[model samples]
Target: MGKKLFIPGPIDVRKEVLEKMSTPMIGHRGGDASTLQKSISEKLQKLFYTDSTILLSTSSGTGLMEGSIRCSTLKKAAIFSSGAFGDRWYKMAIANNVPADLFKVEDGKAIDIEMVEKVLSTGEYDVITITHNETSTGVRNPIEEIGDIIKKYDDIIYCVDAVSSAGGIKIEVDKIGIDICVTSVQKALGLPPGMSICTFSQRAIERAKQISHRGIYFDLLAMYEYILKKDYQYPSTPSLSHMFALDFQLDEILKEGLDNRFKRHEDMANLVRDWSRKHFEIFTDENHLSNTLTVIKNTKGINVSNLNKKLQERGYQIANGYGDLKEKTFRISHMGDYTLDDINELLDNIEDILGLLNKVY
Candidate 1:
């Protein structure tokens, strides 16, 4: 039996979207490919709510996050991290030899706005990276509130890692004044991995021009120049398969209506929240839960690994807690094409597997 994915990314792709991936191959540099690329860019602009140029990388969203931070920071960067993924971003900067400082909040806490203001007010940093959704802890940082704080610093480039939240939630990139809004296909876009998409505002482009040592493969300026000079095509070979799937999936997302889609995610999140409260404790700050996934503390101390093994045998999958919380917490992702009915079924199965149907009730 095919196990249903209740874990975060590479979420279950609809049959039609998967079929789109089997589309006939096209030359990456061909005119028809350029036209298709152009259309995807235009649609992405609408999706990002920005007139800025959008770039597609044949890598995961982490590639763009690395590219944006490396290319846009002429000076130092202050990376605000909430959990594991945020820590990874800080490490990416260091590995690239980019000068950066990381400020990490406690695992379950949201980044305090005051710390952001205090750090940015120093005017020592040229860029700041914020992860909008931290999958490990289920914390969605207050990017809007943080945006309001960072907007006052005109010289500082605002980069956001919205890899998990982009399509499932409304980001309003331009209105939020996010210079580089980064996302990937697998998470909320309901497509397979191997493609990362990001919006590069004119402001971010301008900043890249001044920064030195921007790496070759994922350079923001190189991508922008290639698209402009080569008719919306990328510098290296592009993934036509992923693009075809993304192009079709973006349409599905639009037809679902952005607001309605967000509402659906919120409703699913609420269902998970209520379930977690009844069964286990929510690990993250109660006020800043992620719409994409919920991290539940194992208050009952059930054998999570064993339980997951049983779950797998029954044709369902979920994520154990990340890092140190692996046995203490577990994650349930509500993103990508899952509905309330799906959530109920998964919870019911979990209840049955844990033999808690009667005890919890």
Candidate 2:
């Protein structure tokens, strides 16, 4: 059996969901494909808590991140960063030649709401992007509170990268005043990697129309118009395999009930957080700990790679720290289809491997 995955992305996929990926191919331009896309969109809209149009991409969440910044930023974008992924958004802006500025906080800290207010108060930006969850440091920004700050600026288009937290945490997109919210199937959605999804608001569409040079393939306005004109079909051929699995998995997710699924994630996260506190130390601020993953500081100076090796031998695997935090910190994901029982099993294995079974808290 494959080692149980506890990483951020590419988390363990359900057996039933994997089977759906092989449900035969369909003509990408046909009615069946349109119907499938339409179905997925509707379910996603419910998941996202928004009335905005849903857009699908065959690329990872980064594709739509680059697209959103490129297409919506008519003047300049105020990109906020609390960790690695947030820094990636700024890089996307630079790569796309979109005028932008990065507002960053120290690692493991949450973005100060007042800093965002200060940036927007300058009236130097027409767009803003926030990473709702930073898996790198296990920090979950208070976007709802940030949304309140952004709502005061009607002209500022707010975009959020919910790549790691969407399905696991509750995000009321419309109520939060987010014009663009991006996520992928690989994280908390309990599906394999390859496809990305986003909510595209009319305000974002209007902003895209104002920008003349929105890049081709990832252009939001173009994709939005094509879907409407073509009756829910994309301009490019999509991954029919991922669509099949996503369509089936989304149903399972809805059937499980949104509230119940969210509670499961919260329960798992709490379990891990408590374990981390008892053993090592949580890397991120306690006030903004992620509901999907926990980044634990290597306070004991234990060999993380060796621990993971031992874990793999025991049919379980967790993630080492990301980027510069590697070895200094490690992560344990509680997202996707993982339950409280699953978390207990993984922690039990870690304790055995690290010989922490009787270590006093």
lDDT of 2 by residue, 160-237 (tens): 999999999999999888899999999999899999999999999998989988878899999999999999999999
Q: How many residue pairs clash in each candidate?
A: 0, 0
Query: Candidate 2: which stretches are off by over 4 Å?
Result: 359-361
- Shift of residue 353 alpha carbon in model 2, Å: 0.6
Which pairs clash in model 1? none
Task: Give the lowest summed-lDDT range of ten residues in model 2.
Answer: 352-361
Q: Which candidate is the best by TM-score?
A: 2
Report the number of the highest-lDDT candidate. Answer: 2
Collision pairs in model 2? none
User: Distance (Å) between predicted and true CA of 344, model 1?
Assistant: 0.9
lDDT of 1 by residue, 201-310 (tens): 88899999888778788998999999999999988998999999999988899999888889999999999999899888999999899999999999998888998899
Model 1 spans > 4 angstroms off:
none
As a whole number from 0 to 100, the lDDT of residue 187 in candidate 2 is 98
